[model samples]
Target: MAETGTAPSVLYEERSQRLLDQVALKETDRTPFVFATRFWAAKYAGITFEEQMYDAEKSAAALEKVLVLLEPDGYVPSLYIFGPTLSALDYRLMQWPGHGTDRNATFQYLDREYMPAKDYDEYLFDPTGYCFRKYLPRVAGAFEGLAGMPDFPSLSEWRFVGAMRAFGRPELRESLRRLLEIGERAEEAAQKSVAFVKRMAALGFPSAGGGFCKAPYDHVSDFLRGSKGCMLDLFRNKDKLLEAIDKVGELLLRGVVEETRAGGTPYVFIPLHWGLDGFMSPQHFQTFYWPGLRKVMLRLIEHDLIPVVLWEGDCTSRLELIGDIPRGKAVYWFEKTDLVRAKSVLGDTVCLRGNVPTSMLIAASPDEVDEYCKMLITKVGKGGGFILDGAASIPDEARTENVLAMAKSVRKYAS
Candidate 1:
């Protein structure tokens, strides 16, 4: 790998400390640069996305090449789906690696009402049991037999012995065999992910996040109920929906705390999905989205993990609700929200990252990128607690010169 701009001996520590300092609302020598690109890494390494997913070593090498080229202080090393494994299991949530879509197209989630509206009570009563017995079978064809299988506790009951016979059947055995194959392939992909993370850390770019979480409303909307179903639940099944939301929120917080406790890294990535302005009115957002999400943030903060909130869409109207967090305890990465207004509303309470138009990165010249970065750093990076990043992600087709300009500008202006 090419020499990182920071010294090799202290590079990782230096970059990590820079990010931590900004998270703490302390000024650093320069603004820390975080790049969000997944497929672009594959593109940078001159490989198709499918190749990156199947070949662990190749994927790691591709990420390393991108890091060496862009030299961002931090990045997500891998955001790939194990397409072959998912395909093997006949998983229906997403289509990837040209299986059901174009080879060059990014993976698409085939969202549907995986959980029927009628099952709300069942899901609320036992989320784990419902997921295993109800949801999984619907999504993964290999698990269809699982739906008929008795719940584990029922196995101990004398009357349920008949249900146990299903597991011994040839079809169920074949499904189990297919599942094992999927698990093995998933393990391989996970190993590649670990390798890529280690490679990035060794090269001085630490991961921007230590762990991840989803908003409770999104957990219901994206996975269980479809978007339309979730919206309808807000009115039709208000009480049960609220109960389900709280249950999910509790589960999420518990998992995040347990997973992140020993890592020693403070940041947990919380991608805000389906909570933007267009998704719900301000009052509904206040009612359905913010309460559970805020509970999660506060709990994470209590455990000393900084909640890095990636606001995925227009949240301009909900800034006040977000800004309610304790000062310097969160990092808001905005997509379509106005940065200057965000700064005015949230500057004191949280660190801000974001909103460089992806179009600019793909179409603008290097000089143009430089100018835009200058404006962002000068305006938003005025005080401590600002990170420079693309508004969302660096597209696969983003110009290398423009991306480099973003990194170099931080060095030139902010340094």
Candidate 2:
């Protein structure tokens, strides 16, 4: 390890300067550093995945520990604010009642016994106080817990899934009300989460952590809401589906953008919920994903916030589809994606971030991680668009040697 210490003022200044230069779409003295870390945070801190999700204090501690240790060229990662996290422990709870925080980590559709006939104004989504009125109390409650240790249920409480909750209406409206209530709570949770992030941003190291961004298929796939249902709705009620997506983006991004600008953080996060390869093909990506993404990015840009998308799963198949995005608009947190080709294609447009194997991090020695990262820095960092980062969270169980290797390799090379 590079002596777990705080990055010196010189290093911090140089990183910020270089990153700002990149943001301007210009060359810089050094390539910016980005951390695609998630579970790795808790692990590096000697904690468990369940604890990171459930305990805000532990999550913050881990984040700070990593920041102090690595002191990368840039501090940027998404704030994971889901209702309940999907830990292995939480997933098993699904078999019981309200919802599990472990086991399946998937959303199993609850058969709602009843529902409102599209008329309950206060309970329903109201344009004015809709966000605060419905969710503020829950936010207040969570804030208290987090004031101690709050958590949002991104999972099905009964299941161990991670996603938004707009799809799959149940047979009975009554039972559905609980889900709806959870949705309301989610909205409230998202709003408060943004505020909490803003507070964190102000309190600690300079960073770019923002609100939530879950997709339709994400909910369907993880929650077991049925992809067929969502795809069918795309054809049956395109406007509604579109509206739902827009609502989610607005709820999650808008507040964070405002807070980010006010907080003076240079970057913004767009955490994609669906997988890169399976959710929908490139053609379908254009039809559904692109338009919403364009609007979300555009809106945030209007507020002078930089959007760095966390593209998950194997998106190698969709590289060409993604390359169409305008250059300098965003940086991708690419997960398990093919790099050589991504650099060749997308390099001309957006800033490409990562693709290190998480499995290798868990199994390999420091030498392996070092060799791989060194090659990546040399190869991808060629034209000035690459950002050093893990393709996904360096798995919690990753060998400590692997983490050290990746870090040393990144700082070792002088661009």
Candidate 3:
């Protein structure tokens, strides 16, 4: 262990600086190992996934237990969804562990076209009004009553008196009541997350990131248009879709910079979806996806924030296109992308974070795990711009011995 009596504060500063140094493509003592998992920690700590999602304290404790066990160079708080907050808003995007699945199972998202094709103008011109009046009502049960309310912009001047009458609707009143409850749950969830991050810092661990956002195309695809709808829109409604994507990208950049600054961490985590090689053609990626994502990354870099982008799926084809950002100002965490090829292309451009196979951690023996880590260290971790992590995240079923072997391999090989 690197920790000793009254030395946690010292360790925290050292670990934090080491990670920052690696992000700058500078030399470090060894490649940093960051523990990036969600439900796996709950299973490791003998806690049900349901308990971890609903109780912030339990979720933090479960993750804390794993940190003590593995002692990674950097750690992220449990990225588990807050069940009570979702419940309060009657959120309909996904089914959580206990609410919709077995207590031990992870949550699942339901993908459907929540926005119609004809509504692009409404969203592009007045997104806030459209969401409060149409989008939210269509998705969340608590916001269904909002459909009856007048557009907020129309509520100005003497027209406000007439607009106020919309609240008299029985459903709208109920929506207001639920919104109040949702506000409380949201505050509680925020406090719990901040507290957990502080506690981890005190235990000699630095966070992998302080804020998280999605690629703009993902923001549109995952929440508004379903994959099928968004895919078809590439041909059917390309112009409108592109305009909406640009507007959303700008909005996201503003929120990410503000929140990341307030969170007091320089790294902003972005998990990209829908922009992978399998999801779109290379031409489509150049036109629709890469531009918006690149804009956000550049803006984040300008703000002096490092964008820790996780390419969730195999984006091997888009590697060169994605490497156009400024050098040593970002981290690209790959799921299944080839790290050796990535290193050759991006070694001087940015820091590379991962490529470890999750299946091996779940099914392989300790010796096999050690050998794979050794290969990754010598190949990708050479020349000092790599951080060790699992493919995407550490799965809940990963073997304890295999996980331990991976953590230990860093010292044996990188040292």
Candidate 4:
């Protein structure tokens, strides 16, 4: 590692500047640190997972405590907010907190055919309409009444007064009540989330990104079709699947354009779920996954937004494919990809973040953690296009001292 022997002295603005500089592949004082703390924030605050999900105040407070203690340059605020909302609706897609699963277990998304193979034509014809009418109602029982609602253009014509009367039914009323309750709780949590982000900023930590997107393949696979269903469609209904993927990609890009017009942060978080090497062969990835995702990345770049692509699984073989992204326009945060090879292939093209083992953070000693981070900084942080972060989110069991070693190594080695 290049050692300057300079004391650690980065204020809020300078810290933020250093992060942006690193993303832009420019020289900076040192590598910036971005930590991903999910359920771990609740544990750090000494609160039960249930309390952290239901209690907005407690959740925000816990996240603030974690950020203050760790002092990372940037962070994702609260991953705990969705549990209560999902629970209230008895959402079948995910099990979390005390609902549909163990009280202490982290959130688990169930893979089932929410949209069966037969519905491909409906989905491709009108993705938004199908989602609201067929998909949402089937996934969440509370939204079943939506299936009876009239189309948007015909609603003003009063063509469905009889359908509107469905809301008066006791069962529908009960569902609406639950929906309102969840909505109110979600809105309150959102307010707390905004306050937490501001507090992190005041404490010298900017947000890693303001919004996030999913790869189009994941957009379909994760929600519409289960892994088995999607894989089958890849063989039986390849043409329809590709068309849907392209449409979804266009829709997501349009949403990004609309959202970023006002200009907040330049970073767009993209947590890729289904495009990993294990999910498909190289040809399938290049065909079904990369095309839509590449278009999304290019669109974001065109709009001057940095696409932060979080590779969620082993992507060693896919690194060169991802390198097609323009240089200095994106950040690729890897989870299980080989870091040394990542630096070798993508080092010159994009700003690379992470590969620190979650196991090390949870099981290793502080010195062991320091040595591992030092190795990453020395090799991966050689040039300026690197940020020190964990391979995945910090688990609830991760040792505090080990987490601190990450920051310590960045300061000692990078400087």
lDDT (Cα atoms) of all candidates against the true structure: 0.81, 0.57, 0.86, 0.80
- Model 1 scores a C-alpha lDDT of 0.81
Clash pairs (backbone) in predicted model 1? none
Q: Pick the TM-score winner.
A: 3
- What lDDT does candidate 4 reach at residue 197? 73
lDDT of 1 by residue, 218-284 (tens): 9899889988899999999888889889999988887688776654467788888889988898888
TM-scores for every candidate against the unseen true structure = 0.94, 0.67, 0.96, 0.92
Model 1 misplaced regions, further than 4 Å: 1-6, 79-81, 155-163, 261-264
The better candidate by TM-score, 1 or 2, is 1
Q: Which digits, one per residue and each the tens of the lDDT, describe model 3 over residues 1-415?
A: 4344647788788778878888888878877889988699988888899988888878888888888888788887754748898888778898888888898888888888999889999899998888988999988899999888777676688898778888899999999989899989888888888888898888887787677777888888889888888999999999998998999998887678888899888888999889998889999999999999999999999999999999988989988888899999999999999999999989999999886799999998999989988988888888778888898878888998888888887778863
Clashes of 2: 39
Candidate 3 matches the true fold with a TM-score of 0.96
lDDT of 2 by residue, 267-331 (tens): 77666755468877676677677666767776766766677777887777877766655567677
Provide the clash count, candidate 1: 0
Best by lDDT: 3
Better of 1 and 4 by lDDT: 1
Error of 3 at 253 (Å): 1.7
Candidate 3, pairs of clashing residues = none
